[model samples]
Each structure stands twice: as C-alpha cells, then as structure tokens.
Target chain A: MPDNLQQALGASTNEPTASSKSNLKKLPGDLAMWFFILAELTVFAIFFIGFAIAENLNLVMFAEGKAQLHKVAGLINTIALITSSYFVAISLHSMRVRNDRQAVFRLILALVFAAVYIVIKLWEYESLFEQGIDIETNTFFTLYFLITAFHFMHILLGMVILVYMAKNAYQGKYNDSSSESEFSGFESGACYWHMVDLLWIILFPLIYVI
Target chain B: MMKFWQRYALSWGWLIILTMASVAIGQYFQYATLNSVLFIAIVMLIIALKGQQIVDVFMELKHAPSLWRNIMLSYVIVVPLIITLIYI
Candidate 1:
C-alpha cells in the first residue's frame, strides 16, 4: 500500500511517528551564539558576585544606597523587559509557523517595550545624577553604575539586533521553509534579547529591592 | 495540552506575577514579620524561579541538549544560592 493511503487508513509505517519526531531534541539558535551567551553570562555573574561581596564589606553603606534607588522605577523596568521578552518569544513562534506578518508585528511590540525600559532607565540615571550620585560617589554607586550601565549597553545592542531581525522578517527572509542557518540567525538574535531580560531579573532584586 | 503560543503566554504571566510578588515580599514582609535572613532567602528563591522560566520558555532551551540546559539551569540555581549565603 502507498504511504499516503496507509497514513489515511491510520496504519503505522516504517517512517518515524510524529511523537518520535517531536521527541528528537534540538537546540534553538546557532552554536556560536550559545557560546557568546555563556561568555556574557559569566561576566555578569562575576559582576554580581563582586557586588554582593562589596555589600558584605560595607553593609550600612550598601543598605543606604539601596534606599536611595527608586524601587518603583526598577519594578517598572522589570515589567517592561519581561513583557519585551514575551513578545520576542511569540515573534519567533510566529516566524516558525510561517506567519511573517504577525512575527513582524510582535517584534515591533517587543521593540516598544524595550524602548520603555531604556527611557525609564535613563530617567532613573538622570534623577540619581541630580542628587549628586555618580560612578565615583562611593563603592555602592560605583558598582551600581558599573553593572547597570554595562547592562544598558547590552540593551542597546539587543535593540539593534531586534531591528535587524524585524526588517529581515518583514522581508520574508525567515520562514518555516528557510534554511536551517537562516532560521538559526533569527533565533540567535531572539536568544540574545532574552539574555538581557534574564540578567535584569536578577539585577533588579539585588540592586533595588533585596 | 497547551499550544506553543499558549505556553508562552502562560510563562509570561508567571514571570510578571513572580516579579511583583518578590517586590511585595521585599517591601511589606521584610519588616512586618519575616526576619532579614528569611526575607533575603525568599527573594533569592523567587529570582531563581524567574530565571528558570526565562531559560525554559523564553529562550526555548527546555528540550535542548542536556549539557546546555543544565548549564543555564545551574547558573540560575548557583547565583541565587551564592547571594543567599552572602546575606545570611
């Protein structure tokens, strides 16, 4: 019997079943991108650990510094980044399902939320500066500016990548039928953006709240 | 079973809720009842949970190679553990 007729008749064939095919594990994105992500994560982890040690040494000063920070701003930025990540996730899903238009729209939404983060962050920095706080103010401020400014730069770079992906996606450069390498590039950019969000998840509590 | 998009939505919802919950705990419960040590531990645990969701759902690494997924998961677990130790 023909394979199609057998499939229509609900008969098993030699070919792998859908369940088995779904069980085959495959990592998303390019291998190089994963390596880059690991490197970035290691650096951020070092910075975080350093911050914790510094706080341990100057417990009072660190507590005062935390008090000065705008917790509401931090919370809002957390929400913005997480929402941005959600849009990026759905955007990638739409691309995989061949819904290019929805993918592009969702990417735009992601960019907008990311922009909210940037704007609020800059505002927070400006407010701190107005109160005579700078990287050189003290140990706490130094690490605060150092870690957050570094993450801020990553956010800018991630936005640029998102823009590139959105443009390419709108042009139908990535689709369900695209080559593996092409799809990997799109996924790689999305992963990078998510890394930024993940870093902030830890940073907000460590710096502002906890 | 949830569709892929529904799963993403669910993850997003949880991430948002966890973020807000951590903040509330840090703000309200930190002084009201819980000791400083317990408060910090709770916050660290919440941060770890948030990290896990981002890794598995947003980054789509849940079913990736075991080595890669474990590496990401370990970072989330280890970083928070280290922070908790420092505070306590």
Candidate 2:
C-alpha cells in the first residue's frame, strides 16, 4: 500500500501498531531538534542567572522596575501559555495514536491560548511604551524587554510551526499509526511550543514577581 | 495506569492551580512584611515544581532515557536553587 493510504487508514482505525522500537534512548521529535531545545534552554538559563546577578547589584532599581510591571498581565499570560502547553501535549499524543481529527482540534485549542498570550503581551508592551518605557529606560527594563521580546519571537515562530502542523493534520499526513517515525514535524513543533511555555513559566516569576 | 484524560487532565489541573497559587503568593508578599530571601525561596520552589511538571508530562521526558531525564530534572531543581541563592 502507498504510504499516504496506510497513514490515512491508520488514522481512521486509531491504532499505532506501526510504531518502531529502538533500544537506544528516544527523545521526542528529531535528535537535532533536541539539541536545539537544549541550546535554547541553556541560553535562557544563563540570561536568568545574569538577571539575578544584576538584581543583586542594584536591588532597589530592580525592585522599582519590577514594581512598574503589571503582575496581573504577567499572571494571565502565564496561564495562557501553560494552558496552550497542555493542548500541545494532547495534540501530539493524538497524532501519535493516529487520531488526526483529535490532533487538529487540540492544535486549534492550543492556538487559541497562544493568541491570548500574544494579545496580553502586546497590551503590556503598549502600556509600557505609552508610559515612555523602553529597553533604554534602565538596566532592568532593558533586560526585561530583551528577554521577553526574544521570547516573543520564539512564540511567533512556534505558532507558525503549529499552523504548519495543523495544515498537515488536515491533509491526513499524521495518520501513520504504524510509524512514529514520520511525524517528526508534529513532535518537533509541539516540543518547540512547550519550550516557549517553559521559558515563560520561569520568566514570569523571575521578572514580574521577584 | 490511568486513562488519557485522567493523566493529562490531572496534570493540567495542577498547572492551573499552581499558577493561581504563585500569583497568590506574590500578592501576599506585596502586602505583608516578609524577608525577601524567604519570599524568593518560596517562589523559586514553586517555579521548580511547575517546571518539573512541564518537563515530565508535556515534554514526555519521563519516558526518555534515565540519563536525559535526570539531566532535564536537574535543570529545574538546580537552576531555581541557584537563583534563590543569588537573591539571598
């Protein structure tokens, strides 16, 4: 049988029997992607450590800058990203099980939460900009904008990847219940989206609450 | 093992509850007199727990190789500990 038909039938039948097993440790998505994820995490970790060090030096300025932030917005965005992460996990599982329809639904839900996060972030940025706050305002604001804006770009990229995944699901590309091998795109995209969420999870407390 | 919704939904519930809890902690610190060190310790602990959930459940690291899993787990545990120390 042709690969597409096999996958389509697998999707309808709801069995992942074609999955191949390996004795070696298996990371989700592509091995290259895992390397990328690790690199991204390391960079963020260093940035966070730097932030902590800076705060230690100018405790009062850091506190004042943090006070200017809208904690409510930060909290809401955190919820949005976490919820989106949950949906992305569900969607990835759905794809693994060849339930492309379920995968599509979950992906759409994930995108909705992502949209909420972006909107709230943009609102926060606008508010800050209107108040004449920018990266150059002070050291704290500079790091704040730098870290978050960099993260915001990742969120945007993750969304684009998700849209591609959703499109693939709609076309039945994820229907290969027999082989987890083919759906690297889905796994990788979901992993990237989760990393975006994970970064925000730490960032929220470090930047806004601390 | 628990069914699909049982596992995923429970994790999702925990994430949402923790988010609320962190916000509440922040609010309490904003109003009450507390040592910054103690407040930071608590916040970092909560952040570590939250990060662990995402790594184990969402990232599927729980099923990955033990080595990779431990390394990922340590990132959450150690980073927060170090950050808390710095703040203190």
iRMS of every model, one decimal? Answer: 3.7, 2.8
Error of 2 at A142 (Å): 0.3
Q: Taking the candidates in order, what DockQ does each have?
A: 0.62, 0.58
Say which candidate scores most in TM-score: 1
Query: Residue-wise lDDT of candidate 2 within A59-136, one digit each (tens)?
Result: 999989998999999988998898898999988777756678889999999999999999999999999999999999
True contacts kept of each: 0.80, 0.65
> Where does candidate 1 stray beyond 4 Å?
A1-18, A21-23, A176-179
User: Against the true structure, candidate 1 has what lDDT?
Assistant: 0.87
Candidate 2 lDDT tens digits, B3-88? 55567788888988888888888889888978878888988888889888988889877756677678778888888899999987
Error of 2 at A143 (Å): 0.5
Give the Cα lDDT of each candidate.
Answer: 0.87, 0.83
Model 2 residue B23 lDDT?
Answer: 80
Model 1 CA RMSD to the hidden true structure, in angstroms:
5.4
